[model samples]
Target: MALTSHLETLKKKHRDMSEAIDVAQRAPGIDGLRLADMKKQKLRLKEEINRLSN
Candidate 1:
């Protein structure tokens, strides 16, 4: 279904954001504000995924 595909895409984005967060944390010069924003987006995606799943 369309929802299934969308869910998959969101999950991928969420995972990518998680990895990005990790990489950013390890690096020295990354912007803290930007990283926080990404974390917020990732959390939003996770909420959306959960909403669609149930």
Candidate 2:
């Protein structure tokens, strides 16, 4: 049960990060480093979610 809840939280965070990245891309003068970091974090979350799913 705890694992399921944790997975859900991670999924939600991943979705939120994706949306943030999209918005940041549309904005002017966004920092490349920050965007890359966000993408990396999102990827990590996705990997964790996959691991837990299995």
Candidate 3:
């Protein structure tokens, strides 16, 4: 049960990070490195969620 709740939270964070990445991409002069970092973080969270669920 706890794992399920934590997984939900992680999914939310990943979604939020994805939205942020999209918004950043639309802005002028956005930093590519920072966006890449966010994507990495999101991927980490996704991996963790998968690990826990399985």
lDDT of each: 0.93, 0.98, 0.91
| Descending-TM-score candidate ranking | 2, 3, 1
Best by TM-score: 2
Number of clashing pairs, model 3? 0
- Which model is ahead, 2 or 3, in terms of lDDT? 2
Flag regions of model 3 displaced more than 4 Å.
none
Error of 2 at 51 (Å): 0.6
Q: Write the per-residue lDDT of candidate 3 for residues 2-25, one digit (tens) a residue.
A: 878898999999899999999999
Arrange candidates, best lDDT first. Answer: 2, 1, 3
Better of 1 and 2 by TM-score: 2
In model 3, the Cα lDDT at residue 40 comes to 94
Candidate of highest lDDT: 2
Expressed as tens digits, the lDDT of each residue in 1-54 for candidate 2 is 999999999999999999999999999999999999999999999999999999
Which portions of model 1 miss their true places by more than 4 Å?
A: none
Estimated TM-score per prediction? 0.92, 0.97, 0.93
Cα deviation at 21, candidate 1, in Å, is: 0.6
